[model samples]
Target: MYQYSEFDRQFVRLRAEQFRDQLERWQAGQLSEEQFLPLRLQNGWYVQRYAPMLRIAVPYGEISSAQLRVLAHIAREYDHPDAALLAHAQATQDELQASQPGLTLAAPPLRYGYGHFTTRTNVQYNWIALTKAADVMDLLASVGMHGIQTSGNAIRNITCEALAGIAPDEIVDTRPFAEITRQWSTLHPEFAFLPRKFKIAFNGAAEDRAATGWYDVGLQARRNSAGEVGFTVKVGGGMGRTPIVGSVVREFLPAAELLNYLEAVVRVYNRYGRRDNKWKARIKILVKAEGQKYIDAVEAEYAAIVAQDGAPHTITAAELARVQAGFVVPALSPAGIPSEVSITAKPYQRWLKQNVRPHRLPGLSVVTLSFKRPGFAPGDADAATLDALAELADTFSAGEARLTHEQNLALPWVHASDLPALYEHAQALGLVQPNIGLLTDMIACPGGDFCSLANARAIPIAAALTEMYQDIDEVTDLGPIDLHISGCINSCGHHHSGHIGILGVDKDGKEWYQVTLGGADGSALSGPAMPGKVVGPSFSAAEVPDVVEAILDTYRAQRSSAAEHFIDTLRRVGHEPFKQAANGARHAATERRSHARQAEAATA
Candidate 1:
């Protein structure tokens, strides 16, 4: 974890103070909502469906136990007591009249830790109040965390592969480079208000866990034949409205010049990216419109800058070393030779296979604790859960934890010998779900429940799916699957990249879902990279579960082998079978309704 210096601390303190003053003005009616929107957004505050939502940045998804404690505190204290009042205020008069006064808050108020994780590796508190927003920022600042640049049309959190330093096949430790970019981009005056929001991702491992190929600037660590480290820079890849994999702008860029090269790319986009239309504002749209001409322009810009004051844009070796020093690997000797461990139970075996992965160190392993469960929203962690997990990290692994882009938590360096004991502790805390890459291990955004922009409620769908597939035997037979859902085309849930993607859409004032099949993250194991294809017509939310089951059943029938993955099977035998199955399910549903209606008419 990176430690904050005195300067860093002072900067955060001052920024929080500035926001506090701004918030006071907004509350006092000195600043209109239109005027205050940008100011509040820059601090990661949003006026959501029923109340204000606050997004806190967890940079690169890394947090220490101390920081986790602060987050837990925020979850406990910042919840608005009048949250139900606000909800009722937004309801229709009839609905309000039908509701019981004390029914909503009958249970003890969930005081803290009511936040969910975002695909961007940030935490969002959905019920935060406007007046408490600055106070939340101050609490975050005290723990070396802040929400600055998280939501505005500025550089958002710079993310990397969660297994960056620990992956066995890692070519470089990417955290240092990610941190360097983080420091450089934070509060940079030049790119403060770009045409659209920008995202950057780094991948150091053989597998692209960071979804680098789908970001505005995707940097993959590479080494030349001579073994000198550099980057394979990909530009303009993004989803939402237009889904495109990035183009390789530069085949090889020396690591030392990464900052300068990126600045050149940013300059190109900032100078010419469309500001007239919000829909066409993202760099992906610009790249699509300009084609190879955009690449040529960026190259020419880089050349001109290098020919001019290149010294100003480039980072020095000393500066690089300072950032790298923060990512030191922990010292570890085995606790001792362990007694033989038994795994007689099927559930334990399944958990070990799914939740545990190899580490770079010989006797250590990385453990992913699934946050998805039957009753819980995917990626949600209450305050008590956070506190318990923090203590677990201190006791079992190091005092550090990593948040995955897939909406899970990783104790990245747990000793192999301590697995059994750790599993017990995790189980007690409702963190041991044994479904990491399985069907129930879903990824979803806070949809219509909290976000005003969402077309449908995503969390309920995820929870329903989890409940539907609670049978361990059924999921085991299904094998590894990634089912992602987004409330809308904004693609916050990364639905476009899932093996099975579900997107919520509004149709005649009703919530319907469109399904896309055969999509995947990164390059495929045997075939070309592809996005999920839209499978025929959109279906009602009520029909989604059955439709999903039908799709799975269709896959089971068409697959070459029991072990064949869903995406591979879908690719092998196109989408027609799945489409037929979905249509059949819809027809059967209609017939059932017709039969029931006929029986009622006969009795009458």
Candidate 2:
């Protein structure tokens, strides 16, 4: 975890105060909504379907118990149904409706007191109130957390592999670079307003846990023959309306010149990237349009910047050392060694196998607390759950916990000997689902339920599927299946990278889901980096489960053995078999319902 310096603390406090002042002016009608929109967005506030959503950056998803406690306090104080914040939200909604009589307000859902974890490793409060927005910002600032640059057409939160430092195969502890990037990109004057929102990811490990290939700009830490650390920079990769894996703009960027190289890339995009249409504004579209010419231009821009700056913005050993010092590796105790405490529960054993991984330290283990419990929306945790996690972090993980891109929480330094006790405690908190990469372990975005941009409700589908796949043995049997759903084509759920991807679409004002097959993350062993291909025509939300079941069934039938993964089976067998099965299952389900209705009529 990065500790805030006096300067950092003051900077955030001042920024919060600035937002507070801006809020007062906007509310007083001193500034038009148009004038206030960018300001609010820059602070990570967005007006969604029912209420405002504030996305707080977790800075590579590393959070201490103290910070988590602050979030818990915020949720308990502001997000509860009986909280004054809800009243404020209702008043705001009422005011909007009063001004525009034709507006139909969506009914609010029951209070769950939980903030959601996004695929970007950030936490979002989807039901924040306009009145309490500033207060919430101030509270987050108290814990050195903020939502700044989390939204709008600016550089978003810098993310890295959640297990960066702990991963055994890591070439570099990416926390230093990730923190450095956060510092540089935060409130940057030059790239503040790009053509579109830019996402950057750093992967310091042997495997691409950070999904570097899917981000706007990807930097993979590497070493030269001389054992010098550097980065392999890739550019222009993104998902959404157009999904393209990034191209290697610079094969090996010297670690010292990282910031300069980044500046050059941003400068090039700012200069030539599309601005006329929001749909075509992403750098991927620009890169696609210009092809090799764009890469050449970026290289040329890099040269010019280097020449003009006299030397690139080189990082010194002292600066790197200072940043590295912020990350704390807890001292190991001999008590952390694994114990031979006899037999355990079967589910606990499964959880240990699936959710626990070997940490870089011999006696310590990294434990993933599953958030994909059945009947709950994936990546969601109530305030109470968060508080429990905060306490658990203090007790087990050295008071620090990391959030994964998969929307789960990770205790990166759990003593292996304490696994049984931790498992019992986690089970009590409804956090021990024992499903990490199984079929039930889903990644979904808030669709029509919260986000105004959604075409359908993604949470419902995720919940329904999770419940449907309640047989953990069956789910595990399916083997390492990545099921992802998004309310729309924004790819916020990273649907394009799931083994079974579901994208919600609007047809005749009704929700329809498009299914994609063979989508896998860059760390996938089965194939190359690419978006999942749509299997066939879209299906209704009701038909989604059947379709998903059919796909799994097909995979099971085609797999050579239990050892073969779902993705490998899909790639080997292709989509035709799965397509046929999906259609057949849907038709059968429809027919069965119709026959039951007919039988009831006959009885009557």
Candidate 3:
């Protein structure tokens, strides 16, 4: 919803030109890959597998319909026609060579992909694939968007809840603060190269949607006893190899000095954070090793520099004002929303019950489009689906959309009356799935697909489990199951917090998964739900769902009626029963395999 000024436009244009020149030189071989690596990365270009993938930054998941149209245009025109050749086609590479004459067109063989993420929607383009994603940046500069500071050891996309403006319990609007941090951190000279990547998130609501406790720095809006605006600061939290639920380093910080406090924190890390080991260099490690008391001491020491003995006056009020202006809330409709709608009729009831979040404004809601659907690869959508979403955003809502960190799209500030019509449109697009908070709605990493770090494919595993739970009644009865999958031990899919957690591991090229139980949301800080016994070494794809069903069945039998949740049941009965159930499933499968082998040997 924010418009760009002439300066903003010019800045993007200049950056685009810089990247275009760098790309040209690189293609000409004047700039070698070694020299061009940093340059290309700065421009959000990565030399992924078959082609060069360009990641376009969609800051904090907010984008206007106009900017999306720019993206569609880029995708259509620049992509190599031959690069995206469909699977199981008879056109061999030789045949294509014979037909096209003077072209070296590459085919991805069910492997080439153009996917998006919540953390800066980088428009990843395939290298040697017909499309030159730098072309997208050139066009993007004309509008307000650019692929700047998306990667590298820079301050990553400063995020807040997508429903920042609309969430009913918000103490104050957090979107503006997030936007301010983005502007401040964008290519800041002091922070261009840090000890590790920095992540910051904010939550203004009573219910923390930003995963506030999981960031390097988190801000929760609150007011003091005197009713003055302030924030509750949590620090040193991160997930990746070390999962730490951040502690209250500063306890409480006044809103007026929020930026100042943030500066102090960043300054501390940039100065003292470890740079020797890439894996152990995160600020979280620093926070963990040194203790919170040390961190607080450093913060206080640096915080005094704000407006004290002069530190450029520490981000002048005018600078913050300019950044805040960019995040101005839309003029919401004053007309009342229909609260008396019949919830018992049609699918609107399910949607209202699940997807809709209460807005600060009366009768309005922020609608989250859950990409975690039953039997689909988590966060995988084709070009047509992207265009469909863009079109849907245009027709319904305010032609504004937010990409969520949970790999979903959000159409915030939807008036209550238009819910049903919008629901119909989404259904036509196959976007009308009713498994938002259910077991089928899952979070999984892109394991063994694009990432070289993964041990197995979380996409297929997630899809298989969702397919297994096809019965709606059974799924409903399971009750608020949060199943998470991590490709490795790093916990990118947040397996630690899942009610039923699946961790994929490599047992000498054979795919094996670990299961964990009784994990729940730990924002106020939750406890670790240690893993149960290893589920499988010989588990087939088809049987994974059966294993999950057994776990659910175990929960149901032990639970007090249907009132208790899977987490609650697990908490009560402990992991021994679930472990036994999983072991039983594995044993049955192993017995079948042994019997088959014995029969073959006897016949011989």
Candidate 4:
């Protein structure tokens, strides 16, 4: 974890103070809602369905235990809605359920006082009041955290592989580069409000764990035959109404010119990207529409920047070294490594196999605590859980933890000898679920429950599927499956990349779900980065669980062998059988609905 310097601490504190002034003026009627909108958004505050949502940026997914505790404090003290607001929201939800009887499973009452981890490695609070926003910001500043550039049409959080520095096959540690980019992009006057929100990701390892292909700017670190480090820069990738894999704009960009090249890329996009239409504003659309022309324009811009502007943003070796020094590995006692563990419990063995991962260091390991369990939305952690996680990090990982792109917390420096005790502690805290890549370990957005833009509620659908697959053996038997859900076309849940993607759609003012099959996130398991194909018409929320089960059943029946994964089978057999199975489940659900109606009519 990067420690905050005095200058950095002062800068954050000053920013918080400025926000407090802005918030006070807005409350005093000195600033209109129109005027305050951009200001508040710049500070990472958004007015969601029922309340304000705050997004706290976790740069490159790195977080310290102290920062974690501050986040917990914010969740506990500020993430609360008034009783009337809660009741009204609940009533509205109930009315929606009543209007569409049998279309959805019974969902538990809505709760607050939690933080949500996003696929972008940010933390979000759904119920924080705008009045208390400054206080939360101040608290975050105390620990070198903030919500800067988390929202608006500016460059958002810069993300890297969760195992950035510690991956066994890492070619270069991306954290320092990611951090440098973050510092450069933060409040950059030239590209503050671009055509739309821009995202950048880095992948240093041979494997694409960061899903770099799905970002606006994807940087894959590589070394040339001459032993010089650089990046294979991919541009114009995004997922929304349009999901396009990024194209390689530069085969090899010198590491020193990362910012200079990025400046050129965003400069071209900013000048030509669609501003009239929000839907087509992303750099992807511009790049897609222009193709090679866009690449040429960026190249020209880069040449001009170097020739005319003196390449002002070039990263010097000294600057790079300064940033790199902040990422030193924590001291670990060599005695922590034992030849072998003697634990024989099945649960312990399962957790060790599922949640634990190899580290570059000999005696250390990486452990991911699952947040996709039942009774909570994926990536959600309550205040108590957040505090407990901080404690766990301090105790086991030298006060360091990283938020993963998959909406989970990972301790990257856990000692191998502490695995058993750590597993027992995490299990006691309900954080040790041995389903890391399993079907139930799904990615989902807050959906209609919290997001005003959502067409349907994602939580209930996630809950339905989670409840159906509670049997660990059944889940493990199904093998590694990426099940992702989103409440709308925003693709916040990264549904477009899921092996089995569920997207909530609006049909005649009712909630419906469209299932897509054979999507891949460019992982070793998923061969390439490609969007999933829709199977058929959207199904009701109630039918989603059955549809999923049908898809899984189809995979099980069509698989060449027990060891074959679902994706492999889907690729081999194609989507025809799976599509038919999903539609069959929908028809069965319809028949059941019709029979229930008839039975009710006869009774009446």
Candidate 5:
């Protein structure tokens, strides 16, 4: 974890105070809503469906136990909505549900007092009041956390692989570079307001755990033939209304010139990127529309920035060393390691195989605590859970934890010898599901329940699927699968990269789900990065569970052997069979609903 310097601490506190001033002026009628919109957005406050949402940045996914405690404090003290506001919101939701007679409208009751872990490794509060936004910002600053550039059309929070420093197959540790990039991009006047929101990700490992191909800019840390550190820069990859894998712009960019090179790339995009239309504003669209011409433009821009500006942003060796020093491995206390355990126990063995991963350091392991459980929305941690996690991190991971892009928590510095005790503690907290990378370990957004942009609710669908797949044996037998759900096309849930993607769509004022098959996130198991193909027409919320099961059943029947994964089988065979099976399930579900309706009418 990168420790915050005194300057960093002071900067965040001053920013928070500035935001408080802006907020007070807005409340005092000294500023118009138009005047205050950008101010609030730049500070990461958004007015969603029912309430104000705050996105707090967790840079490169690294966070301390103290920060977690502050987040828990925010959830407990500030996440609550006013009683009258909650009642009014509930009434509005009920009316919306009643308006659709035949639809199931699987919207759960509005929830608050919890923080949602986003795919980008940011923490979000859905029900926080706008009045308390400044207070919350002040609290976050106390612990070296803030919402700066988290919501606006600025270079959002920089992300890296959760296993950056510890991955066994890592070519270079990306955290230092990622941190350097973050500092440079933060509050940079030239690129503060791009044509659209931009995202950047870094992956240093052999595997693409960070979904680099699905970001506006993806940097793969690597070494040249001469063993010098550099990056394989990929630009224009994104998912939303348009899904495209990034194209490699520079095969190898020297590590020292990272900031200078990125400046050129963004400068080119800022010059030529579309600004007239929000739908086509992302750099991906510009890159897709222009192709080689775009790459050439970037090259030309790079030349100008280097030749004319003298590469002012080039990272020096001393600066890189300073950033790297902050990420030093924690000294492990020998007493913290548990000595004895029943290694052969089935539950313990299953947890070890599923949740625990190999670390670059011997006698240490990286453990993932599953957030995909029944009842709770995926990635949600209430006040108590957040506090407990802080304690867990202090005990098992030297007071450090990494928030994963998959919306789970990772203890990156756990000793292998402490597995049993850690397992027991995690199991007690309801975090040991042994379902990492399985069907039940799904990624889902807060959907229509909180997001006004969503056409349907995602939590109910995730919950339904989670409940149906409670049997771990069945899930393990089915093999590794990426089940992703999003309420809309925003791709907040990264549905475009899932092996089986479910997208909520609006059809005739009713909530319907569109299913896609054969999506990959550029992992070794998932093959090349690509969007999933839609099966058929959208299915009602009621039919989503059956439709998903039908797709899996088709895979089971078509698979050559038990060892074959779901994604492998889907590729070996085309999407037609699976599509047919999905539609068949939809039709069957429709007939059943019709029969039940008929039965009720006859009794009346």
Candidate 6:
């Protein structure tokens, strides 16, 4: 965890005071909604259905025990949702109407200020019963935090690989560079307001853990011919209405010039990127509008600004050393020897195998806490759990816990001998599920529930599919599978990389979905899932289970063996067979009531 200096602390405090004054005026009726909207949004406040909700950006998804405690404190003080979600109605709208005698009641709207720590997409604090949002900003500033740059058409949080320094395959410790990038990009006057939001990711290893291909700019740390550090740059990729996987612009970018080159890239986008339609404002659209050759040429010209005009940017060796020093992976009771490795030696070995990775030191490994396990909300941890993790990290992991883009937690420096004890503690805390890399582990975005721009609720759909594939031992046999779901076309869930991807849409004001197959996320296995065939209009919760079951069953019947993954089977057979199984009258979930209502509705 990076400690705030006096400069940071004072800056946040001043910003808080400024925002508090602004918000007080708004509440007193001096500032109109129109006057306050952009100012509050820039400060990370949004006017939602109920109240103003503030989103704090956790760049590259890293947070400390102290920070987590502050978040919990904030939740306790601000969230007004203690009176939420107790009255149980039918689990599904269909279940309530037919099974029980007809009684109609509007489901109560859910409560506010729920703290959801999601994998990589964002962490949302549903805390706005705020009559004074600016005051909240001031409070956050008092704690050395703020909502700055968390929203708006500026450089968004620069994301990086969760396993940047931990993954065994990494070429360089990307954490250092990611931190540098975060600081450089934060409130940068040159980039504070851009044509649109920008996203950047760096994968420090060979394996694309960061989903680099799907970002506006993805950098992979690699070694160049002169035996120096550099990156392979992928440009113009993004997820939105038009999702495009970035193309490789530079095969090798020297470490010294990476930042300047990045500046150049931003300059090009800022100068020529669209300001016309919000939907078409991403760098991807600009790249599409301008040929790749032209963009590549701009980068080359800017390379001099990087290597020569070099007032000083990019990660210098000293800066790298300073940043890495903050994340010293702690001196654990023993960094090299985990305390209870033998406890998880058998059934839990898979957890250790996939979830844990070797750190930079001699024997220390970075242990990942998987939130994507069966039955758990992806990236969600309650207040107690958050506290326990903070305690464990402080006591066991050198008091450091880094949040992942995947919305899980990480204790970066654990000894091999201490693994079992940690595993047991984790189990007691409801964090021990061995489903890493399995189909049950899913990546989804917060669809319509919280986001203003989403089409459907992605979390429930993901939960449905996760429960839909409960028979894990059997599903494991099908091999590696990635199923990404997005509320809308923004592709926040990385649907294009999934072996099977589901995108939620609205058809004529009716909720419906489209399914795509054959998409992948790697060099060996990367391709678009074919455009989805529309499915369901107001499909019952019961129907969702059947739809997933049909897909798995269809795969099992055609699969050569359990060794074959979902994508392989999809290509081996075709999408039509699965579609038939999902939509055909033979399925009990869909037939009770036709989904015809949605098809007749207007385009979503």
**How much is the lDDT of residue 461 in candidate 6?**
70
Each model's total of backbone clashes: 5, 1, 16, 0, 0, 21
lDDT of each: 0.82, 0.84, 0.68, 0.92, 0.91, 0.68
Candidate RMSDs in Å, in order, are: 3.9, 4.5, 6.2, 1.7, 1.4, 5.4
Better of 1 and 6 by TM-score: 1
lDDT of 5 by residue, 1-604 (tens): 8988999999999999999999999999999999999999999999998898999999999999999999999999999999998999889878766765455635667778999999999999998888999999999999999999997778999999899999999999999999999999999999988999989999998788788999999999888889999988999999899999999999999999999889988989998888899999999998899999999988888888899999898899999999999999997656455635578989889989999999998989999999986768999999999999999899999899999988999999888888888888888889999999899999999998889999988887898889888999999999999999999999888899999999999988888889998899988889889999999988888888899999999999999999999999999899999989998998898898899999999999
Estimated TM-score for each candidate? 0.94, 0.93, 0.86, 0.98, 0.98, 0.86
| Decoy 2 TM-score against native | 0.93
List model 1 lDDT by residue over 1-604, tens digit each.
6677788889988999999999999899999999999998998888876778888888888988888888888888876547565546345323422332211111111222477888888988877778888888888888888889988889999999888889898999898899889888998898999999999999897667788888999998999999988999999988888888888899999998888888888989999999999989999998889999999998888887788865365767898789888888765435543434455676667789989999998988899999996667888888888898899778766788998988999998788878877787888888888888888888998877667898876765676678789997898899888899999998888888888899988887666789998777784342333478998788766567778999999989999999788888988898999999988876776676578778989999
Q: Give the per-residue lDDT digits (tens) of candidate 4, residues 116-215.
A: 9999999999998899999999999999889989999899999999999998999999999998999899999988989999999999988898998999
Whole-model lDDT, candidate 5? 0.91
Q: Could you tell which candidate, 2 or 6, scores higher by TM-score? A: 2
Off by over 4 Å in 5: 95-107, 336-341
Best by lDDT: 4
Question: Cα lDDT for residue 564, model 1?
Answer: 89
Tens digit per residue, CA lDDT, model 3, 514-540: 777766644332333233334344344
For model 5, name the residue pairs that clash: none
**Distance from true location, Cα of 481 in model 1, Å:** 1.2
Model 1: how far is 133 from its true place, Å? Answer: 1.3
**Candidates ranked, most accurate by lDDT first:** 4, 5, 2, 1, 6, 3
Error of 4 at 477 (Å): 1.0
Error of 5 at 174 (Å): 0.2
lDDT by residue (1-604, candidate 2, tens digit) is: 7898999999999999999999999999999999999999999999987678889999888999998898898888876444665666557544532442111223234345679999999998877678888999899899898989999888999999988999888898888998998888898999988999999999998778888988889999999999999999989898899989998888888898898888888888988888999999999988888989988887887788788776556688999999999987865434543434333668878888999999898888999999997656888888888899999898888889999999999998888888887887888898988888787878999877778898877876787687678888898888888888999999889899998899999887777889998886788453556799998888876678888988888888899999999888887888889989988877876776678778989999
